[model samples]
Target: MGFLAGLALLLLGLHLIGEGLSSVKGKRYLLARAFSRPGSLLLSGLLLGLLSGSGTGLSLLALGLLEGGIFSLGQAALLSLAATAGAGAWVGVVALAQREVAEVLLALGLPLFLFRGSRSGGLVLLGLGLLFLGFLEMGQGAKAFAPLLSLLNPGPWALYLVGIVLAFFLGTANGVAALALALMPFLGQGGSMALTLPLIHIRRGGQRGS
Candidate 1:
């Protein structure tokens, strides 16, 4: 029941986002102008990479903002790949440090499988459905570890480190952000500093619009 409700919310949110983006099609010219600048695409990529690495949804939102047909489909595709990769790497490292392979795959693969093929967006709906189910199973498993939580309670730094790993493997900037928020109260100063990553890029290049 709870999982169904959550899945419904996820679908609703995606619908609203798609609708909103479509409504703004008139602004394509302005975006074209901005995106056409020489360093603009790379800056956009950097902004996306940093935001993605930090676990914020800003990078994905950056992709949406650029989706005004200002940039070619190829450019947007590359940006999505880069942003997701950077974000995934950050989360993957953290996840491996905290948990086993099976847990990690359940956290990721289930969604990928569910959302594999769709004409418009059966993918989004199904993926969210799988994620909701996955998390519920996770929570059930978590109950067994309740006793361990008490042991780790005083050592909040330990949890924050674990939380960082949790965020990274999830492949969700939003998930990462939520985890960071939940764990922030428990974290010490030095713990927060560990979140930053060095510049994320090899060579971001594309044509500029005039």
Candidate 2:
């Protein structure tokens, strides 16, 4: 029950993450000017990933920028790199600060989502709130499943395969990483961590179709 609930919440959160950002596409255009310099483009991508917490979302944004001539293909590539870095950093931040972030988002998001117009970025706030909540729930599910799952040793390769599958399970790289950690606690601590990076990298490439 909890596992399914967590999965559903995660998927929904990711959907909102994509929609919320796309909703603010006009604002995202500002990032193109910020990307004028190589170093600044990377920094902009980093900040975008930090804010949106998803490389997939950042990639779509970059595509829009590229098509609109706001950025070159080379600059888009740089943006993708920085976006992944920022989103990777965000995973740790979310793990440690879930409670604080969740609380703030909820307090700010509920009313905004319900009353404020969609143009107000309410959906974005609500999506972030749900994203944090889903993480907390997923953590609980992991802890709950760990003990029962510990007995199963699927081996490193098999565990890694599972990690790859999970990484591709969600729209955002961060969500994929989170799901990888949540589902593979049976692989033991360091075992799962070892697989996460490669799995995320693979999924990012798949998402990029390159």
The residue-by-residue lDDT of candidate 1 on 34-94, one tens digit each, is 6575467556555444322431243344456556445676566555555555554543333
- Give per-residue lDDT, candidate 2, residue 43: 82
Per-residue alpha-carbon lDDT of candidate 2 for residues 126-166, written as tens digits (9 for 90 to 100):
76677777777887777777666667756677666766666
Regions more than 4 Å wrong, model 1: 1-120, 176-210
All candidates' lDDT scores?
Answer: 0.40, 0.70
Model 2 has an lDDT value of 0.70
lDDT of 2 at 128: 69
- Give the distance in Å from residue 180's predicted Cα in candidate 1 to where it truly belongs: 8.7
Off by over 4 Å in 2: 26-43, 72-78, 115-120, 183-186, 194-210
Question: Which candidate should be chosen as best, given TM-score against the real structure?
Answer: 2
How many residue pairs of model 1 clash at the backbone? 4
